[model samples]
Target: MRELAGRQDDEGHGRVLERAAEAIEQASGREVIPGGDGELAGELRYALAADVVLGATYTGTLPELHPGERLALVAVCALAAAMPGCVLGDLERELTLLAGELDQAVAAGRAATAAAASRA
Candidate 1:
């Protein structure tokens, strides 16, 4: 769990990611295995992150958000967007942190899935 601190965009993401993680963890009351395109889900995220970063940052054309901050911004924006009517004016600082949290969750989830598959 590497923390991306001191760099811009890694701000309020921690809180949002924590919330997402909580939601996910709580939802795990049943260990029902998911079927259909699990790898697609993971690949889609990478594609989505790329799309968001490119669209929001205009293919790195816009000189807005620092040199390495677009990805975090995109992640926070995605999380906030996913939850309808989520207010983001408050958690403006932890955006990158949330992104990192998401990265961790995704990684952990994939690892668990792979391990389960191996045992199958």
Candidate 2:
């Protein structure tokens, strides 16, 4: 039962992250190359922030995320916002790492719940 709940949570979180990534990509325009330095970074940062806010709204519920998770999310958001050039690839990598961390947290939570259940 707990496993099911955890899986649901994980799936839901994955969807949210995907949407956030998509939003960021869409707002900033696809096929970002490389170069443009300062101007590109500024544009990316703004777009990323907008995407995060959009994702937050899409989820309906406020994120009850841990500090570390929140920070990672924000870091990725900021990175996307301040992308150096048309570096969509780099931004995607950062987002992937952030999502992985979130997945680890969800797995840990599920494990904890399972341990408690076993004890009970």
**Which predicted model would earn the best lDDT?**
2
Q: For residues 1-120, what per-residue lDDT tens digits would candidate 2 score against the true structure?
A: 122223334455445555555545643454344543424444444445643323345556643343244444555455444443435456567545644654564455456555656666
Q: Of the candidates shown, which would achieve the greatest TM-score relative to the real structure?
A: 2
Candidate 2 steric clashes: 5
Model 2 pairs in collision: 32-86, 33-86, 44-81, 45-81, 45-82
Residue 44 in model 1: shift from native, Å? Answer: 17
Query: What's the lDDT of the predicted structure labeled candidate 1?
Result: 0.36
Where does model 1 exceed 4 Å of error? 1-92
What TM-score fits each model?
0.28, 0.37
